[model samples]
Every structure is written in C-alpha cells, then in structure tokens.
Target chain A: MVVNASQDDPEKARRFREAALPYLDDAYTLARYLLRDAADAEDAVQECYLRAYKHFDSYRGPAMKPWLFAILRNVCRAEYARRKTAPTAVEELPEGGDQTPMWNEAPETPEKQMLRRFDGDTVRRLVAALAEPFRETFVLREIQNLSYREIADVAAVPVGTVMSRLARARAMLRSAWLAEQEQAK
Target chain B: MTCEEAEVLIHALIDGELDAGHAREVEVHIEGCAHCAVLMKEYQEIRQAIAESDLRYKAPLELRRKIEKALPQPQPQAAPSRRSVLRGFAMGSAVSAMAATGLVAIVLRNDDEQRIENEVVSAHLRSLQAGHLIDVVSTDQHTVKPWFNGKLDVSPPVIDLTAQGFTLIGGRLDYVNAREIGAVVYKRRQHVINLFVAQTANTERKTAKVSTLQGFNIRRWSDRGLNYWAVSDLGADELSEFGDKFESAMRANKEG
Candidate 1:
C-alpha cells in the first residue's frame, strides 16, 4: 500500500525519525510488558518504527508518544495473534483476612514496607501477570505516565474504561502483594 | 457522596484524573468514612509502589544497531529512463510510483532477511544467557510438535535425530522480524542448536546456506513454503550435518 506517499519527501523522513526516535524507550517498555520477552519487544519496536514512518503523514496529533504507542500496541496484538498462545493467566488472589495494614494505618510506613516486599523483579512479574486489557492500561498510566485521554486514544477505549482498568489493575497488584506477603509468612 | 460513589472516584483522585467538583466530593466522603479512607490510602500505596519499582527496560544497544541498519535509507531520485517513460505512457505516474515502491520493498525485504539472521543469533544468545533455552522440555517429537500447534500459525515438522547425535530437546515461540515463529531446540553433545521455522509466501525450495555471527553458525533454507534457520555454537561441518539430517527427515516425512 502506498501509505502517505505524498509526504514521502526526504525532509519528512528525517523529521519523522527525529520526532519518533525519542520515544523508542517508551515504545520498548510498553512492548516488553505486552509481549513478555526482550527479543519480541525489540522486534515489535523495530516494526513500530517502520510502520510509523510509513504512516507519519496520518499523524496529526500534537504528541508523538501516544501515536507511536498506538502503532506499537497494534504491532504487539498482531504478534500475539500470530503466536496464538493463551494470554498468560494471573494466579488466584489469596483468601482469608486482610492481614496487611492499609497505607494510612501501617505502623512501619508504606514506602518502607513496599520497598522490603516488592523489588523490581517482583513488580515486573506482578504487572506482567495481569490480563491484557488491564496490563496495557496500567503500563500506559503508571509507567509511561500517559494521561487518561491519551491512553484511551491509544487503546481505542473510553476514558472511563481506562480509569476502571487502571483501578482494577492496581487493586489486583495490591491483593497479589498481600498474597505474596502471606505466603512469605 | 455515598461510599460507593466515593470508591469510584478514589482511583481518579489517586491518578489526578478527577475534576475539582468530583475531587471535593471524594475528599469529603473519605474524611467522613474510615473505610473509604483506608481504601484511598491503599490505592495511594499501590501507585507509590509502582512508581518506586524499577521496571523500565531500556532497548539493548545491539537491537538499536540492527534497527538503524534495517531502516530504509532515502534513495536519491534519478533521471527518468526509457523504461520509466515507456511505462509511464502505458500505465501512469501512480503505477510508476507503485513500481518504485515495489522495488524499495524488495530491497527492504532482503535487508529484513539479514536482520532476521542477526535476531536469530541474538535470540540464541539470550536463551543461553537467561537459561531459558527451551520452554517445553521433551525428547519425544510427538509431545514437542503438539506444543506449537496452537502457539504458531504453522506447525514445524519435529523429528528426533538422537541416533544421529542430534537429540530433540524442545520448542519455543520466538519472534523474528515482525512475526512469531516456532523455534525447536536440539542438543548436539553439549552444544545447543535452535531450529527456527516460519511460514513464508515464497514457494520455491532453497538449499541451506551457512553463515557465521559472533563465532556462532547459522544455516538458513526454505522448503515447502517454510523458512528454516538453524543456529548453534557447534562447528560448521557438524551443524551442516544436522541441517542435512533435518531436511532429509522432513522430506521423508512429507513423502510418507
């Protein structure tokens, strides 16, 4: 397909690369979360760049991060479908009482306890364990720091859905952490 | 606002996504109700935990280099030739542009093949580095082949060559170029070999061609519309022998 050929001028290619390359790290982070492998994420980001370059003229938005991420998300979905593997399932949350104290009531402080309980690896695993919809929203909001509107635009969902997904994702992570703490005990 | 309404607004408040009026309502509700207050506190804690977690993964340098190499370089427009003029008359400017695009695509596809080779080597190295060489460990070809049935768009022929020194280890779903492909593992004595298989639009059969990257050997060929890339730390002769055995076995399986 001759996508955006009218704007295929040399200057446009240069401009596109300059604008889109800055978000390479952002794209890689999102792809890694979605694809769940370093090699796959890298490949996804590479393809995202090529596809973005082809469709650069269609990008009329002010920010490049979300636009680039939208393409990356599509690329990831295609890759996911090609793989045909079932979505990585999240383990069931632990049962019983809320042994862990709420943020305001904890005696040791939330920051200290969180640092002790959840390391980088733990956090990544927990986030990766989330289902696709919740995982995408959580990564965009929490990690990429995109606004609700931008996330909705990239995910092709409503702002309200983004808010709820983020909420559910956080709740799931909190409960998973409680489960991990319980198991550790 | 009731606690139920307040609970819905709590996430927006933590995310700084709430409007002034709604924020005020949620704040008032939290102040009045201890239960909602604790939920708010927990939400804040979860957000903080994520913020504090070191989860951002940077793209590796090698991958960056590969991407840079693979990006299409702008070609200098040349003067119109006789072929272009004749074709323009026969078709039009749009057709000529499409022809140009097709040529560029061909060049890009060739470059993509080279990039895919680099990726195969990188994947092999990563598997060894992470000690995740195989996802489904087994010696039985029946078990290994079924594992990829649903995982990949195409089922790669899995065969056991233990009698020939190459033993079936397992298979994994690997991403190369832009598509997911099946990568079956094999063991040659202590050396590990990865046989990557992907479906291709090209129908012609190709003889195996050997190349080396970072001291590792890679042999690639296409047969029955399936592209196969075998990579390993084994010697060139031994790896080629493994490839020969694999190809012949696949051919025999097809015939039978």
Candidate 2:
C-alpha cells in the first residue's frame, strides 16, 4: 500500500495532529450541539480539521483551540446551511413552563450538586431548547471557558454580543432545566 | 454606584475585566448593595452551572482520532528540487492567494469572524511552540521577578497587568532567540496573551511592530532591555494598544 503525496509531509501532518489534539473534544462538542447527531457532528469535526489544516498557514497566533473552533464553527454552519430546509423540530418538553429556571437555584455544595444531576436525556432536551446563537454562546463560554472576546472572535460577533447571548443562553437553559423537573413530576 | 451600572459591570468584574480601581469599587458596592449583589451572585452561579452542565455532548474519542488522522498534508511534489523550489514557491503562493481570497469570502459572506479569526489563532499556536511558554508562576511578582535574576543576565521588568484590565494569570520561563526569556500570562475576556519578554541586551522597548503570521497578531517591541512579543488571536489594533499600555506600565514602574 502506498501513502499519497498529501500524507507524506509528516511535519505538516504532525502540526495538524498536535493542533487538532487538544481541541478535538471541543470541536466535537460544538459540532454535536450544532448538528444534534453524533455522526453528523463527527463528520463536521473531521471536515473542519481538514479545512483548518489546509489553511493552517493563515493562522499566526499562540492559541490553536479558538482558531480550530472557528473552523469547526464554519463547517458546522456550512452543514447547517445545507440542511436548513430539513424539518427538524426544536425539541421541547410537553406542556412547558416557559423555560428552565433551575439555574436560579442557589449555588449548592459541589457534592450535593452532583447528587442533583439531571439525566442525559434531560440535559440534551434543555440544550436543544435554546436558540442556536444562545446555545452556541453558552457552550463556548460555559462549557469551554473561552473568553468573551474569544467567543466573539469564534462566533464572529462583538464581546458585548457574546455576553448577551450567554446571558440569554443561561436564561433559556435555566428555564429548560426547570421544565425538565416539572416533566419528571 | 447605581444598580444599573453595577449590573452591567458585575459579569465583567467577575470575569476580571475591570481595572483594579473599578474592581475595588465593585467589591465595596457588593458589600452594601443587596439586590445588585444577589444579581451578581446569580450570574456567577449560572455561569458555574453552565460550565458544569453536560448540556453540550462530548464527541466520541474514536471520532476525534479519526478526524486527526484525516488532516491534510502539504504537497511534496511542489518542493522536490532546489532549483524548481522557486517555481514551486510561485505556484504555492498563487494557490495560497486563491485560497485566501476564497476563504475570506466564505468567512465574510457567512458573516462570521470566527473562521477569519483562526488566522490569528494559528500564529498563537506557533508562539507556544517557539520555545518554553513562560518565565514565572508565583502569584507574587516579587518572587517571579527575582527568580529570573541570574538565569537572564539582563532581567526583563515584570509588573502585574491585573490592574489594567489584564490579569496576571501566571508566568513561565521561556526561550527566544537562543536566550532564556520570560513569558507572562494574562487574560483579557478569556483570551490568553502569552507575552514573551526578554532583555533586548540594551535597546529601548519603544518601537512597536504588529505582525500577523498565520493569522495570529504578534505585537513586538523593545523597551528598556525588555523585548516584548504580545502574541494572541487578538486583532492588530488591540494587541498594539495592549503592548503600548504594558510597555508604559513597565516603564513607569521602573522610574517610580
């Protein structure tokens, strides 16, 4: 079996590998959220990394995560755009109580909080309930600890927008979470 | 002092975006202002919850590995002979140009800055690999500064940027230009600027040049034996401004 010319450049290949390593989980997470399907998310991530590697020379900074994320975000957008007309209903808890306000619950001890963990299904539903922008901001800021500026850079928005979206995202998440408990009742 | 102002700034304060003076003011207000304080705590708690939530699903490890394996490589045929390397270079340049224009169009037409920002992100990664990342790690500048005394013949001045909307998150010993260097880490809106500092041997750190390599903006300058390279995915103007502010602060502390 012969390796192709594209696979021969180990340095470039390693650069891509290393750069994509730390951020693979993150990229996948973002893609999963955007596509709402594991396979599509995986595909999106794979495509995004390839797109990123080809254009890696255009990147000139110390951090690779945000840049890779930016690429992943673009790939997700492209995928989403193609499937724009698909009849995917935003998931909603039946007989909803506006939004999940469980986020308003007072901060509890970390251990107690773990005991109160929502099931995977509930968490999925709650994330699904959020508007795309809010969901994306929430994931990048809350899940990834990306700076508002970095989120803004990745989302291609102003930092102010990142904050607002995050706030709204939290608000929506809180409502969705509360709705989950209500449904469980 | 007002509740409205406090609310807008509360998240900023928690994120450490406020100046020291403003932070102090916010801290003082939070002690007396019940409603504003509650709101602040709520936001923080909400942020914490979101961070902990499994709201965003993790991509399977196998998928991640497969993606890594599929990354593209540069064409070797383009760089085969030294004499033909120039021709290869010309073709490569043209290809890159076309790719650049197409990419910019894709990114801009998508009305998303995230993809365009990756250009800066690549530069940020390059700096991380240039040498060891930092020169200090102690919470106190005093400890960090003294540690570099003998390691570097001319010590690069170290001052905390925490007060000026840049929190001195940490520091590490780094290598640049075949010499031991200092890298001070700071966070601005969560974007980490790994500020690489080394004594210029003798040159003043005044002339600032912002260069974008692989999309990362590197603001390089020399001031009072300290050569500073503020590398981040941050835009040119912001990095340049940050370099200016940092240089001034370093200079002022020296005079004081």
Error of 1 at B135 (Å): 28
On DockQ, the leading prediction is: 1
TM of chain B, each: 0.59, 0.46
Q: Fill in the DockQ of model 2.
A: 0.20
Predicted candidate 2 versus true structure: per-residue lDDT over B1-256, tens digit per residue:
8754565567678777678998888888889987666656655765565556555454554564466446543332221232232332335444345444432111122322233234334434633542323435555678777876765454556677767777676666543322245566776786778777653222222588777767668876665334567788777877777787887886687578
List the lowest-lDDT window of 10 residues for candidate 1 chain A.
Answer: A96-105
Clashes of 2: 45
Single out the weakest 10-residue window by summed lDDT for candidate 2 chain B.
Answer: B103-112
Q: Poorest 10 consecutive residues of model 2 chain A by lDDT? A: A106-115
Tens digit per residue, CA lDDT, model 2, A1-185: 26765464665665656555556667877788777778888888888877887887677863788888888898887876667556764443343232333334323221112223575566666776676777787777666778888888898888866655565565556555545655776
True contacts kept of each: 0.50, 0.42
Expressed as tens digits, the lDDT of each residue in B85-146 for candidate 1 is 33443453444374556522122367657867887887787667444577789999999999
lDDT of 1 at B172: 77
